[model samples]
Target: MRCDTLLLSAALASVATAGRSLQHVGRKADDSLAAMYNNVARNYASFSGHHDEPLHKRSQHQFLSNKTSSFAVNGTGIPDVDFDVGESYAGNLPITSDPKDPNQLFFWFFPSTNPDASKEIVIWLNGGPGCSSLEGLSQENGPFIWQYGTFLPVKNTWSWNKLSNIVYIEQPVGTGFAVGEPTATSEEDVAQQFLGFWKNFVDTFSLYDYKVYITGESYAGMYCPYIASAMIDENDPKYFNVSGMLMYDPVIGPNDIQGPIPTVAFVDYWTGLFPFNDSFVEDIHARDAKCGYTDYMNKYLSFPPAGPQPFILPGQDSDGVTSDECANIFNDVIYAAILVNPCFDIYQVATTCPLLWDVLGFPGTISYLPEGAEIYFDRADVKKAINAPSNVTWASCSDISVFVNDTDSSLVPSIHALPHVIDTTKNVIIAHGALDMVLLANGTILTIQNMTWGGKMGFQSPPVEPLYVPFHDDPVEGSIAGSGVMGTFHTERGLTYAGVALSGHMVPQYAPGVAYRQLEFLLGRIDSLDSVVPFTTDKNFTEQASEADLGEGNAPQGYASNWTAPASDTTTVKTSPAAKGIELSLASLAGVLLAVFYLA
Candidate 1:
């Protein structure tokens, strides 16, 4: 079924302008913000866990017989139900690891739409340190997406569950439907809690043999590395085979600290916005010069609060600097510039804002799906059907106090755990949306550039290479129509860095097709990371393209100007197929026209 063109157009336009038009102001008094940081630090320092206990002894589980009673009639008696064509299981499972902090983590699991006993199992989390992973399910790559203003779901043709069993868990104690006093203050605590949950989930489901892949976006960037590391360190391969991890628009620390400032500057110059004045830009450059490195901003931002001082600016003599200046520049100058440009979205520049500023102070704009899903999930009948707690309110994004009090340890660097992950896992994919300004692609690239894996410090050769996705329209027989350059990929020593074009922080929602193809490549369904030549209906083209990594199919016929190849010596330019003179169907034409008109 086609989407509502008018709704789509409006969404595109709004999302495009959402982050633009902020009013920048001068610096403010440091005491208030400084106090906030001090409180945060105190919260961080106050956190204590059962660190003395052995890792294996920390996890405890209790199976609720009542919770399984509502499951759809599958022989296994799991909370399984048919949502359209696929099977789903939704409810809460208890983690009694720390009896003092008993928590029930909510999970929504969907079996692969295409049944395969040996298909991989993917566990997905969304990073807020408090955000619900249900957003990833209903809004991003889940089988059914919530239709705004309607109490119905639309089938997402490109759902990730097509070839993998996907599980979305609302983690930490206080997130989503999970109930308990929030106690996890560090990623280590978060990982320990997850390990407890995983043991119960896998044992109950009898899924010990399935190959598992840990995945998430944003803050999950931190969570994934730590979780993957813990799984590797604790679980035996015979019982829990952790294949890999995939991070989308992640907040990998250190590199991500002051990364936004330089990213904003580069984007402004590239897009001809010149948002920063000469004085501010000169100050930034002068600071960089004093630090003797271009990435000094990130270094400064990465520093933790030592006593009262949170950060020390370059060339400063005393450690009396407050974090207020850094916060002001990020909010007032950098973010404000993006807010002023209706054409630029901080998450995805090509799209308009789909979110409105909340009356409550949420750092980013809240999405409509979470609100709609909350309504749908909270319905009495739906709750009965899913066997969920009827009284608990379903929240898309959790309360900020959860972060302030229970997740302050997120400030601790999680990137330090990636090396251990790379050494153990089959592969590690660090992907970012090219248009994402929140966690910029350049920052991810920098992080990867500085990483060491397989006894090597970095890639010995040039890393950037054009990544192509098949044109959905008029795919050639047996071969794909290389329609456009969707993104770029660089792989070295089991570590891969990818830039997804035409996407935002929520990559699966913005560019589902490319995102799906990227996952296929990561899963080894496709031969190479750069080119995607799916087996097409046309026998001749498939045979030809199958022979070489560079397929024999003609370049894309109709969509040439959509994606441009990056300027690099290693980049390979492919010729688009000759135009077949096939006009788009009226419905397709109308949708295209609406998008163009609204975007223009």
Candidate 2:
């Protein structure tokens, strides 16, 4: 099966001391290291010293530390981040009602930049079934990004914070910043525990009846649906008012749906990257025909599914173990691909020779980080700034299992939960990055075709509309660089399928402009992906927003080359007041940074 929860096992433990990080892929850390991390987490200080902080920043942090109360964090800016990060809240909340419970769920909440979507809450989760949502915060569609090869963190002008009050949660227990023991063995347990934590979160902020949108990527596709079903079952708007949902490259059905059935097609589409010999390609193609995968695609992967679907049976397959030799073609291709290209990445198949250094240790398939690079989140100083636990050494994905059993006692999301969620919310987006090989787009389509939602089995017509990103006035990137046909999308019965072009496993990291446009459609700003909405204009700003005309495809030559000193809009950025006594001027500081990004 395709393990979606495979994540950062260890990126920095060895990078600092010329050692190597633990190479545990798809599971928890090795036993000895896990024990050490757990022991340290249980006995560390609430905050740590960051000697490298600037004097002014130190003063600001001091002011924030002096004034502390429940649920208050980041009263100032993050340590080592030169620009204003804006005000935010981060801390662990106990899953149990007891005040002294050690089982805690960690969260980081950032308010919206635009006042219009302030009441709307977007909860973001990352799947590894163990990966930390903080990864989503720092690298995906967050306020800032420390990209794989980038020297310094750069502003993500298309941060989701611009549209809604977004919160990232590391969940199901043994995740990043989470402190607890494994207990459950099913998705049901995962959902109930999450609901308990969510109850605490909403009450803390007094969100009695806010419109909530649940979003995530990878294995989170399985998570978002179940969580949504649980909320809908509650029938309590005050506690679980979910209005919409979105997932990227989700695992809604059996693994084979997104793996074997369409893998050959995927490889064929990107032959430039695989470097397969003609004979090898021909043999694999012959294997495909013998396996019946070719017939499966021809019959089932239709505009409207040809018939009722069940699990895929590869190689004229049966009983999960077919006699046919080509049954293992999917993995066979991977083994061959890796042999040919040592640096091949299944998440993004286009990856080539010379792997890039990553701060998160596991850059691609192996653990790696160049010398002098620090894992930002693991540093005690960073933990203090974010109000994360220091007792346990943090890994992007938990080294210990979150569940008592490796396998879940629940059906895949598509069969039961996802359809219910789609019918209830009436606003759902299931997006997939075109370049993601781990979960092929065609496989996802097959799953969708099999599932029933809104009284329909599958899409009546094919997705044809172009996903457009309008030209904006920016200097460094220029209008042309950011404006164009980002992808394509289609909607039927409240379900939208967006195929993001040139994006890999993580859409936001590879195609921020496309992700931004997707958010615009999800938040009900524009009618659909084809709507010509400017970066900022939405239904909320009727007069000022409507007047801004956006180009359809590309602007005239040199239209973006002409640079002029941009005028500043002294608009105030709205943020929460710091707790206790000393309140930092986060609103003003955030405003200054916002002005520079041309995000007014």
Candidate 3:
């Protein structure tokens, strides 16, 4: 994948470096998008409508499923399956990072699943500041796999694990697989746990001194860089050889630059979504100088601040619920995704929904209906560690937070006294589904733009350049649709920041192909020419191929190349018990709703 294209001479004409405290790199295009963007604009506009319907509807299948990281521990264990498993591979080595939380850490050692046995290790992170990496493992890359309504496992054609040795860590003490250790309360505390886990992980798996690359998105934007920085500080010249860090749609800085720029950026995003609501923008801007963002955000967005805000799920039709109803809808979607996708697993699994409800401040109303059913994709350890709360679903929030802090201290509380830092040596890519309101990429972009960079030696200097590249070329408009829009100049020297096109904050779940493709491109850039692939000919197909050849001696002796097709569902349902149970429950729910509507 070698390209001899020269830098397009700073795509935009050089700007004057005058009294401006911050150098802004952006296109001065009118807000009215031209023809090239029609498709993307349409996609962006209608993004909320897509999610109302299920993914299975989009794919024209019974339901969407990811095979590699499916959750099926309760009823029957998933069959051991094989795929490229990364070229010259054998078996996967699964181990725990924390001895106390044994099931929290899960890693797939890919010594080049492709025919080429490469030695570079890249860690994959999914962002939520509180989400799971398993989503990335199964949905984006590796062998694709997903569960059908929490029971069966499916396969994915795209798996990053296949390209590199990827470790999916459920972090912090409270996230998926990991038990919320009573000890952690702040970011720094979690940092120590992450380091401890990584140390054990490498030592136990004989990977103490491997070439490491940390990568992730959303809050991971904060997670990846923080983890990399922490690893560098902790490892330095010892345990792990740290190469660099990569972040996608990262939440680095809070967009509170010198002036009201951060304020302006946030307002721009909010207004873009709610075009007519300049009143809020004006009101916030008026006090942005005095009150500040942290205060303003909590008041307006979170509970106890302002009233509830309307939630928008892109690619789905709006149900037009009240503010309270909107909040309920957002909460419901999150709960449904977590609960219904029993095969779906996340950071840490609470014992019951009520426990999760307790965490979120909800009470007895939420049902633990799927009662005895297991969260399929959740780590067994997290399940055991937390005692498995019924009302709550499992996720990797703790891990995400810990990793974010480890990547960089910018997110740490008191550390806020210091200026934000970006590792210029690393290229950060953040992608998301535009339709996803659960975690908006807009917020992510605004976050990155606002971070302050304390210039450091060796790291790329801050405020380097921001480039806007279209995703694809469109002939009629001479522009690309669903491409890039936002970028930050070097926050610290050497760091590269990129935001995905037409994506929500959760890039993998939204645009898996784009995510993996961007990652592959990023790896090429990070490793420099050292990791470049050579063009080869597929003798049988007589086609030219760009395959990375890591040479023959380093290759494994031999690998099992057999592939298996998943078996069809054949379990006969014992309808008598389940039918009677559901029938009564449905009837009860109907009576309640009818009573509420008519009697009221």
Candidate 4:
């Protein structure tokens, strides 16, 4: 139940596999895996082992059973469904053919409000590596935001499904209402399963003509790329026309190393919450000087100090230091900063004081949400209406054990995979909330600046340009009479890097209007990328509003407001008991690995 306890369990499990290389860790597939592989080889022989074979061909549970219904939809619990009866589908689609270890993935599909079926099919995923897309559906960008206080759903005016058919899929094997053992231990496996799910999804819905755009926030950043790559590798344009991908506040880099450094610096520099003492600052500088971290912020990929060089912390010595020790120093500073901040919501800096600190330290579920979503979704009536499995309990995030044995936690294959996706896809857009500390905009910018795509290593022009989105108040919903600067965007060769202002990890939940316009641009619904001009406004004339009037409150709770400076200058850096346990676990894992190496 405790975050540290779960992390420790995961660490121990990971360390147990340290002796074997990833390639050889599970090379000899189990019976079920072998059967799945053989199925692919037999049916899709031409594409077998080509990475382009439809994952469904490899799945043992290739047939899909329909569990859809048109029962009385719960108005109080359902948001945006004004009509009593409408087209909606929810059920489990088998991802693998293995009968013994069937991986049935859960999905909720909402048909586009447009009846013509002319719109593209947009799939939204939430990244916890273990989290559910249902969170995105109910709390963030879905048609309804669950209001637990009244046990009612509020209409999300800017739902992505407004102009596109949106499907929220609970992926991998054990996430959300999906049923199976938590068998997937890597992102590659996840992609394979997702492709299989997609094949079933299209077949079941008969949506072969619809273009696909994959989008998600957080860990989905890592997921979208691999999924896109699979689609590209499959080379089936008729079945998989992946036009674009859009991600907000995604985890693009590997977690254990260079990824955490830029985030720590950005938070400390921007929030001023963790005011390091002069000695600490000087110590960091000395270490940086000695460790040759001259371009630490911009140049992070050239890290791990090449060879025999010792790893150094900013304010600490390099003597007898291991790579893990240096990584801890970077991670600790960020962790300590969160502990010191009154509102520990790392995704949104302006949160006054967060209530759900229990969610922290869990991968991908760090952001806060309304209280009653879990309860509401679990209700038998609600589950039945959506055709969810009666036996399975729905959760916003998956259990830590689902990922404890994961081999890809420290891997950044997604980053390397993006260029290939970009090369094949029509367009790719990466957006970040400017104020998010969890995955800072600065880090994202630096990563993009260092990336190679479209025959160029990086953008030739400046990486910052003003991005504008039409502003509209709730009173005047449809029309955009005025414009406001959303953030900055940098573009080159069908790839765009955007910074969304007054937002956090969940872009749609915070700045829905801007997010909607951004989606329009990515979908090619809008003509120009720089400007968004709304078509019409409410008949009741409204005057242009000031910045304060349009900011913060528009965002969900725990996501709006200015950072309230702590009253006292004296800052106390205290590590949580959970954090201490995590530290001890890491140390123990490292010690064991060292002993193994020496013994070998």
Candidate 5:
């Protein structure tokens, strides 16, 4: 899944973070919690087992038939919280049409709070070829989030489920709570089994004609395209009505191009963060040019397309890989940097000290938890409450490799599948976090520049346009700082490319508000990425309001150099073109974990 995850999704060197603590602005009810987390502490803060949140209840008639009711989950009242979670369904379903098939895939589905939830289903996935999607649910965009350094789980004001039905699946066999022998050896095998699982899952709820939106992060960049392509091939709307697709910091391009090829640009652009000496910096640059990576990037990372790029590195075709020195550039920088700051985090690059205990166990690139901190999903009581199989042990990232030799031959999406998906769906969004060190954002740009879709090679124009986020009353995350210029995005034909400036590999976890806005764009709930509203739907959005939002009082509609908003304004904050000392490790171009495998 993650590189450290056997080199699949996102994996990396262990680093810590220190310095400023995060503050939450909440109502009087959560006043006590506001004081509890003053800063990131070396010691675990004591939290109250008490909760006064309202338990979401089924309104009137049941949404499920008697046959499907068996799958209904107990509104899990965690041992720690007095209130039950929102209405949801979870468990394993046979991956095949045959009920007796030993193969099954695990899933947790939360119907949206909206009345039209039945008409749509948004699928959320994580990248490790074997990473569990529950990580997204518990720590990212799901309704409830338990972030690092927080004393207790709080309701996510920007949870995706607030707008559409959301489903988090633990995919491939042997990942997380998923049971069955890990037999698949390729993405096709992964996709085929997933399709089978999908059929069973929909039938269980008697779902049909539902608009399916495929969304995931990391290696899911790999999983989604293959799956979406398969769904498109199915030609059966009842079962495979994929309306749109979204991926965050995904590995859709060639792993090399997405990682090592752009290593230098990432480093040079964010040069301030790496503690590497000038000699180390000069070494990577020299190696970069000698390896032909420097030429490859300059040639392909341009508009109007560089006439379809091929494996341009010297001896790539003959050797079938880049030179060892070249491949090791990414690993070399990270390794050296971590030496100076063992607390140096590749995922965020902004973190420093005592790693906060993670409920998922795997926080950032390393697996860690404080003493007595039981993983929420692995808790026997939690499993029983959520209709999960108590027999299976769960880990955020799988311990065993999900594939043979850790190899998948399925082509990178940019080569064939991604363009096709973009053409057909005409509603595709590929978003990357600027702060991610595992997959550099510029590398994704290079990939896009080479891709041809909708009769064009790449974006003819750069994304200097500012992406606006409406002001909100979110207490946990609060609103972003500055003018709400959270990120930059561009739409060409059916494809939208977003560069979330302040986020990391996990967009929803690092920049939930920005991720939520992208969701709004993907679902067609908003006409454009730039809209001004605390929260807007077709019912209340206005062109005049949008025009007013772009007035002189707001930051200029361009990059950060022109932006004038303060960094921490409660109503609207700016995050892109990162300010001084606000480091964005230029995307995890070479996933941090790759270092452990190739250079460790």
Candidate 6:
């Protein structure tokens, strides 16, 4: 696979700010990173996932499932449902402010609690690079949501708030309620601002000495590591006590464009799921050999283009589905039948479905929940109790600027250096869901194998899954069933890098129990006197991480420096020489056709 660190670096340039000193980690302003921050301030409703459709589309089952929507009872099997989560706790945080711009101070506060009375705290950031953690706190992973025009409470199975004092901070100046004009010009600038936010967060919350773990997914990958490094770099034993980190399906590096990963792995991933011709994938692999050993993606092996899959456009049902169709499918079929909204509710797109019109702004309509679902952030009951505003607007989509800005700045340097950084750490865990189309797991593996950690050996080898568990629950089988794969990482030195279980890009969102439990195991929060858990093939064995193993005494220093740039035709190396020739021919033919058809 081709890995181009520079391309990733170029993308992050526009929004980057200069890096700040770690000594003032908590004091800087402008840490909030998002495209929505500087160039524009988008309406809230526009931020939620919606297409340009006038009304949302709906599936037959979605309509039927909506018919079964309930506000009276919690769900089919849930008992003693107490829906009363409110803002019993409140706090404020400040960011760097220009004396000239009085109203431009950055930073916002989120309620945190240590349900277990522990000194450990975990900060949760939902990655959009520009998306709001407040939304993540209330709507997606937190404990409540604003409902029916009021604050409401919901429960969470994997609430990090319960185990550790969880803090959700709006970062990168322009993100969430943290308001500031954007002037950042480098990734280092963004890193400095983030460090400033963390320092301020610690000072304001009086948790400067707390054992903290920074965690997130997507673009947050770009933010978390740099911030963590800065925190540790300051060498403030109290403020810099970053024990370890957990990144769930993060976009940490620029492997997508810089590495051969996209070229080699994408073919297998798409073919496995879509109706692409089987020969197409084989042909592509034959053409580009870097797509090494993709047997794990056998499920996606299909024939030529499965007539382009349906596209969900806004305002129209050309595909006969609504704006919220994808989400509805996720909510209704995957989790309990908590309808998030009619397929039309998300995008407000015009649609032929009468239900879209009926449900649009229907009175007494509070937040829609997927069945068998519970609110994590601002629950309906909590909103009512607090008299909070219920009708907050959600953006239909994230500002493209945020992703472009964050990735452009953060991914480049990091991707180039990640292998080295990972090598020295003794633990580097990367996992992906086989079925996830957006961030294909096979692509992750391909990227990893091609990477040379610490410039030494390439991070190669198949993941050894010691245990396998069915992820999703299917009524037909009366048990959880699905291709929920788990990968256990083992270092060449015999240390357990990490174990990743079956989950989508947002692993924590899909199975918090697994995610949190894994974190605890990683951080040695469990009762394990042993400093390390040796890998075992026995099915019943359970392993855990020990603090001693992760402490300063055991942690390694600089990684080896044996990295080598791969050849330009990296994708062609994985196949036999004969296969490679055929692929070149096909690609050449395709290029000629496109040139004649489009350019001519």
TM-score of 5: 0.82
State the number of backbone clashes in model 5. 35
Instruction: List lDDT for all candidates, in order.
Output: 0.52, 0.65, 0.35, 0.54, 0.68, 0.35
Using lDDT as the measure, name the better of candidate 1 and candidate 3.
1
Model 3 lDDT at residue 432 = 33
Name the runs in model 6 displaced over 4 angstroms.
Answer: 1-82, 86-92, 97-117, 138-140, 144-153, 255-272, 277-407, 410-429, 446-461, 467-488, 491-502, 527-600
Model 5 ranges with Cα > 4 A deviation: 1-62, 314-317, 477-483, 537-600
lDDT, model 5, position 453 = 86
Best by TM-score: 5
| lDDT against true structure, model 1 | 0.52
Residue 555's lDDT within candidate 4 is: 15
Tell how far residue 255 is off in model 6, in angstroms: 4.8
Give the range where candidate 1 is weakest over 10 consecutive residues by summed lDDT.
577-586
Candidate 3 vs candidate 6: the TM-score winner is 6
The root-mean-square deviation over C-alpha atoms between each candidate and the true structure, in angstroms, is: 17.3, 15.3, 22.0, 17.9, 8.9, 20.9
Per residue, candidate 3 scores C-alpha lDDT tens digits across 1-600 of 111101111211121101122233775876566544455544422222211111121122111124222221221122333222222111112223434553344343333333221445777766544455655554444443442222233344334554456666655444544544334443454555567767765554456566676776545554565566666666453455566555554444332211122233332443333233455446444444343433433323211113322232211136522233212222332233333332111111111221221111111122122334444445454343223433335532332333322232234211331122233233333343333332333343333333334332212121212223223322212111223322222222333433333444345544444454445544542221111221111111121222232221110100112211123323211111111210000011111210000000
Which is better, 1 or 4, measured by TM-score? 4
Clashes of each: 21, 7, 104, 11, 35, 118
Which one wins by lDDT: 4 or 6? 4
lDDT score, candidate 6: 0.35
lDDT, model 3? 0.35
Q: Write the per-residue lDDT of candidate 2 for residues 444-493, one digit (tens) a residue.
A: 77788788987778875555456676544322131112445666666777
Stretches of candidate 4 exceeding 4 Å from the true structure: 1-86, 97-101, 115-119, 147-151, 256-258, 273-294, 298-325, 354-374, 409-411, 475-483, 535-600
lDDT of 4 by residue, 387-496 (tens): 77798776565544444354454345334678887777637778877666556565565456566777665544433345565544432122111236666665666677
Candidate 1 residue lDDT tens string, 382-460: 5566566777776555643343343245432333578788777647777776665555555454455455567655444
Q: How high is each candidate's TM-score?
A: 0.67, 0.78, 0.47, 0.68, 0.82, 0.51
